[model samples]
Target: MSTRPAAGRCLVDLSAQDRLRSRAPERAPMLRVLCCPPAGAAAGYWRFLVREDVHVLGAQYPGRESRFREPAAPTVEALAAEAAAAVAAAPWARAAITPGASADVPLVVLGHSMGASVAAELASRLEHREGIRVALLALSAKTAPGTAEVASTGAGTGAGSDEDLREGLDPLAPGADAAMVRWLRRLGGTPEAVLEHPELLALQLPALRADLRVSMAYDRFPAPVGAPLLLLRGTEDVTVDPGGLEAWRPVSTGPVQRREYPGGHHPLADHGDRLLEDLLACAASGRSG
Candidate 1:
């Protein structure tokens, strides 16, 4: 099959507010979670986190899903800017972040893999630029930005990800690009059957390639922020080691906490329920708003 997406695949765009509004607006959210999807993913990836008392806002990156027609974010900073702008406009930001503020909604910014880096940057903007307080900045499955280990390994750069798609394909099966396939497998977030299904995988390649390019080319690392941090990693995840998670400590002036799950790169795939339970516990302390 051709790698090009089908014609009916949309090319229009929406304002960030309309494209990525709160999952539930009527309820007074006990906590607000602004999430960034991992490389190759879209807003739907965080659907599991939606709850009646929680407001989930998954920043929908361009060039995928509903925004498939728009240009993909050129860099991590640009994506963070978009998310910052969107969340800054929300009504929740008006809530005071000071201790004991009555209306303050506990805000958390979360992302996994390349999204983790983007989330950190977004959290920085929310706190430093928007004058908002992010109760928790959660980074999952990625090393701290600007860490020497990342430079040494080309982690998140999509480097060394492309291998032969032609080498082992059956004679009758159609050929597809292999770079995304390899990267998805490397990240361990996607299922094996989906990785092998070229047509479906190809449909996701445009956005995936764009996000990988952003990760590979980004220059800015998040400046240290005052917010507390939550670092999540899979115990067996080769993509991010213990040192990488620990590196995040220096990026925050407040408490830096870590949680390990039982899996490889995609620990959340099996443990999102557990993660939500933990986040609820996290919010309890920050609820004073």
Candidate 2:
């Protein structure tokens, strides 16, 4: 468990002007999808994913983007708690259940890499505490918790020197001082200009390291989540082995399905249409569940 900030302040507060951004607002949305970005990324990563039926809201973590001044969340639990609260208090949540509107507008949660673990915890919190039933819990490029432990005990704990941090990112990127650049190239969402600036990279390190620490140290929840789970993986993803994806089957009480795309790790970039189709189908099923 990592140290939490004082009350009334959090690393990522959706209520803040820049934390939770709407990607598709031109048309009325039948469902709302809250997306969490991969490690070292921000909410703007989902800007390209526009759909009329689904309103995409990106969750912006602190120590990046507009919240660069705020301290990053020390643990995944803390980040999840804050995110859950923000969702519960969001205007969209209220509009979804307003009278004369749709009976039950679905709320889908999607995440990638470290974001996947955070989404799991957020879904659990929302279901248990806020009585909000998530339509779908979609995860990508991440192994199920409690099955395979992320190497958090040693040098990968985010406490090592800058060189160690660069080395740890080698698998995801595989280069030297260009660690951030390589990672962006592989992730396929971040802007090239952001990676090119040394000042921005310096500002991003704390949040990235904190995210890594929480992800590495995360433990599986004691109980299975109630929402249907969909696992997406890339055929070429070296970070998450295909064998470990099946572990998600036992972690959800609802239906569990796994699919592999043609690319590696970042399926949304290479297979956005297929991903969107599957996501919409899953949300429809959740509405009828």
Candidate 3:
């Protein structure tokens, strides 16, 4: 794992001012989004989801921003564990619905690609440890756990061990930084400076591997999560492969809204308002108030 600051603290600082202003007793958020980023991506990647209707919280793993100084985790489990710890430590510990209250302040958790798996695990952790109910668990672009056979066409399929993730990243190193930079360029993320800086890669390498592990090895809980679920697939997404969406049907007890958008995997990047509208629409009138 790459070492930086805590992922939770960075998110809190980045959105603190806006979050305070958006808080209203009647109009408080019906959902608190905890977006997990795919391999090599950071929490800010989902900044498009932030709005007045929902309290959006994005988790920045180690080696990114405030947490950039901390060593990154090497495995997906470690990353999820870190995320689970962060969620547990966060100040907003209230359950989706207040105890004995008729109105359930729903929490809609959205994860894209690898982040989707982490979101599911986090939700499970929240349910088992904190006993908080997840109103909705939205998994996009990635397969739900125990459904790895469907992801055979992906670049690196199946749950990966720590050694597997380490080996996967072994091809790039001090000598292959240039090749890595070229790869990052096509990925369309990461700053030029970060790409050029050897030190930064040293920090990011762990995060990249950890993210890949999280993506590869994530398993959905067998016992159905006590929440509505959604699976969003981009018809054109060639990277993650949309095969997993079909498998979600049997698992989702509540309304399972599966959408096939025209764009590639990251639909929110091009269809921010549309996606936000869909997410916000899940909020009940009473809950939104």
Candidate 4:
């Protein structure tokens, strides 16, 4: 991969929203949940998760959406650090300390697929470096960090030639071409129009490939995180083993809960309402405890 300058900041500004639109009163502290999208996806993937009580801010990765021209992050650490910086700088992080609030507002981190590991790293960074408390960490459709290799299907190291890259992605899209369309079809998120267009698919491949490399190359620490954890998996998600989902129990010192939904890999889309309800309940439980 060609070395390039880091991408421009992609954080979405929630502070700019009209205060009247906030369902929570000025004196009422609200939970802020920062979400990280899965590989080959952008922040917009979480737009369907909008809620009136909690603030849902999605982390935008490089080389996608508004950041399409920038280079994708080379490592999971780089991505996590950048995301942490963006979250720490957000106005809500400081607003929690304002006089009207009864207590410090809670912050929760949620991620899906490859983003599970990224969210874990971000939670650790916030807790250790910024002294921020992560009320809960919600992970979906991914195994514990440092364990992906155990179940990975021998995909190429993500650093091979173009043909090798295509070959590695073959299992992901058996009879289809190694294009974004194939992956998008398998994942069931991207719009049909975008997937059908060769030009659009080409535009998404760089970031997708970069994110895959980060997942393949990630090296996680053995130590567990301090925050409570909730693992959500799709019952039909063949990509992640049930045992692997259960394995996350030991990764957190706080309580760990697992829930299964009826869908494939993208359970959030199929079960967004249920997941959101559970996420809020988990975060509240963690905060109260």
Q: Model 4: runs farther than 4 Å from truth? A: 1-8, 13-29, 95-103, 148-180
Candidate 2 per-residue C-alpha lDDT over 60-130 given as tens digits, one digit per residue, 9 for 90 to 100: 77777666777768777777888777777766566443433555567778888888877878877877777
Cα lDDT for residue 52, candidate 2: 57
Report every candidate's CA lDDT: 0.68, 0.66, 0.61, 0.68
lDDT of 1: 0.68
Name the top TM-score candidate: 4
> Clash totals for all models, in order?
1, 0, 19, 0
Residue 13, model 3: lDDT of 26
Q: Quickly count the clashes in candidate 3.
A: 19
Of models 3 and 4, which has the larger lDDT?
4
Which stretches in model 3 have alpha-carbon errors above 4 Å?
A: 1-7, 10-14, 17-27, 95-97, 100-104, 146-168, 171-206, 219-223, 248-252, 283-289
TM-score of every candidate relative to the true structure: 0.79, 0.77, 0.74, 0.80
Q: RMSD in Å for candidate 1, one decimal? A: 7.0
Candidate 4 per-residue C-alpha lDDT over 83-167 given as tens digits, one digit per residue, 9 for 90 to 100:
8777767656664334344556677789888788788788888777766678888888876554443232212112322343455
> Among all windows of ten consecutive residues in candidate 3, which has the lowest summed lDDT?
149-158
